[model samples]
Target: MNGKGTKARWWARTATTFVCVGAAVAATAPSAFAGATGCNDRTCIAVAGSGLRVESVTASTTWNGDFNGHLHIYGGGIDRNSATGFWGYHQKFTVPVGRDLPNGSVLCAEGWEHTGGGLQLRGRACAEVHF
Candidate 1:
């Protein structure tokens, strides 16, 4: 009945509407990194090489051991040393491509675990960069 009461009710309704809209949008929207590379099982990997001269590698492991493993990245114009002592739930590695990769170029990465004085495969993943 009062002006203040009407204004308060309007603000509350507006807030509720915004919340509902946000939830709806989130549910319907696709993943931001839907094209990202991913791996499964004891280890996981994701790569994004959309930038020039730099590529990102994300490696993760669920294995609880004395030594988690190492991240190896290869292919393209990027050649770097493997990451050692990759413990914990995840580890990130980066590679510089020196230049933009040609269209349909593929980059591969893998996680290796040390077992019984030998290296064993944990998880492997790869991604293709398109020019």
Candidate 2:
């Protein structure tokens, strides 16, 4: 295999291991936040908004297995989702640092499901935040 392919496989393996460890930790841990939820689904988790100033946003989807959602930021600003035809998908976003959002700048994920779509959301997005 090529060097890129080998590196990708190694990364995937490491990521999978991290996910498993995270799951185990979550299963035994107790959360302090009342409104927080965690998953790889419709509502993933509650990101702490305390002292957080959002600076930017970016997202990506690795495979076409499940999700095809758009992120609605700050209420009205729309950021469409990305998909790689037949195999992969990806997306990126940018947000201002001081923009206010629900529950500390909520990023709403919305999508549709069909014959090729299931209910899983394997992809995620992240933003730079300053406290």
Find the candidate with the highest lDDT and give its number. 1
Model 2: per-residue lDDT, tens digit, 17-61?
A: 999999999987753322222323332223333333333333323
**Cα RMSDs, all models:** 10.0, 19.6
TM-score of each: 0.55, 0.29
lDDT of 2: 0.40
Name the weakest run of 10 consecutive residues (lDDT summed) in model 1: 31-40
Error of 2 at 19 (Å): 39
> Could you give candidate 1's per-residue lDDT for residues 1-131 as a string of tens digits?
89999999999999999999999998886533213566644555566544433356555555452245676777666555465775566445655443556556566666677777888877666666653
Q: What is the lDDT of residue 101 in candidate 2?
A: 36
Query: Which regions of candidate 2 are displaced past 4 Å?
Result: 1-39, 42-50, 62-71, 74-87, 96-103, 112-131
Quote the RMSD, in angstroms, for model 1.
10.0
